[model samples]
Target: MTELLSDQRIDEALQGLPEWRRVGDAIERSAELASFPQAIEVVNRVAERAEAANHHPDIDIRWRTVTFRLSTHSHGGITEKDIALAGEIDDVITDV
Candidate 1:
């Protein structure tokens, strides 16, 4: 299993991911997509990645926006997995 990241490590990772923010013990970002279908597609991509990593984010999808909040529930805090997943999501949506 992937190990949870330390607080310091989480801080360092968030530096390059400006859209993501620390909220309580999780990292969060809200994405405004072009349409609801596009948002669902984004969610699908994220789901594939999460399944592969065995880590998942709490996702909320609206009409044209998707919000992702990630945390290591087992560890009761943010972790490297959350950062990695967030980065992956950001990359996937960069050209969308």
Candidate 2:
């Protein structure tokens, strides 16, 4: 089972993910795309990564913006998995 990240660990991870912010026990980020279709495509990529890692985020899709909030449910908070997946999403979407 996954473990919850400590406050210190979460802070350290946030340093590497400047685009993400802590909201309670979750990490949140918003990415803007060129169009709705492009936003959906980004969601697809994030879904694949989430499934592969067995960790998922709450994704909100608007016209051209996608918001992601990630936390480890089993741990009742965020974990290393959330940070890693967030990084992967950042890498994929930055190139889009």
Candidate 3:
């Protein structure tokens, strides 16, 4: 089982993830893609990465925008898994 991250640790991790911010006990980021298709494309890519990491995020899609929220449900808060997945999501977004 993963341990929850301390607030200070989360803060330090957030520095490297400029697009992501702390929301409650989760870390989230929203991306605006070129179109609905592009948004779905990004979501698909994120899904692949999430599967690879064995960690999934809550995804919300509206038009050309997609928001990803990462948290460890078992741990009931943020963890290193969330931070790492957020970075992978950022990389996936950059690739698309």
Q: What does candidate 3's lDDT look like per residue over 1-96, in tens digits?
A: 689999999999999999999999999999999999999999999999899889999999999999999999988999999999999999989988
Q: What is the lDDT of candidate 2?
A: 0.92
Q: What is the lDDT of residue 5 in candidate 3?
A: 97
Q: Best-fitting candidate, measured by TM-score?
A: 3
Residue 48 lDDT, candidate 3, scale 0-100: 90
User: What C-alpha lDDT, on a 0 to 100 scale, does residue 27 get in candidate 2?
Assistant: 98
Stretches > 4 Å off in candidate 1: 1-4
For residue 18, model 3's alpha carbon misses the true position, in angstroms, by 0.5
Using all chains and alpha carbons, the TM-scores for the candidates as numbered come to 0.91, 0.95, 0.97
Which of the two candidates, 1 or 2, achieves a greater TM-score against the reference? 2
Runs of candidate 3 exceeding 4 Å displacement: none
In model 3, what is the error at residue 8, expressed in angstroms? Answer: 0.5
Q: Candidate 1: how large is its RMSD?
A: 1.4
lDDT of each prediction vs. the true structure?
0.90, 0.92, 0.96
List, residue by residue over 1-96, the lDDT tens digit for candidate 2.
578889999999999999999999999999999999999999998899889888889999889999999988888899889999999989879978
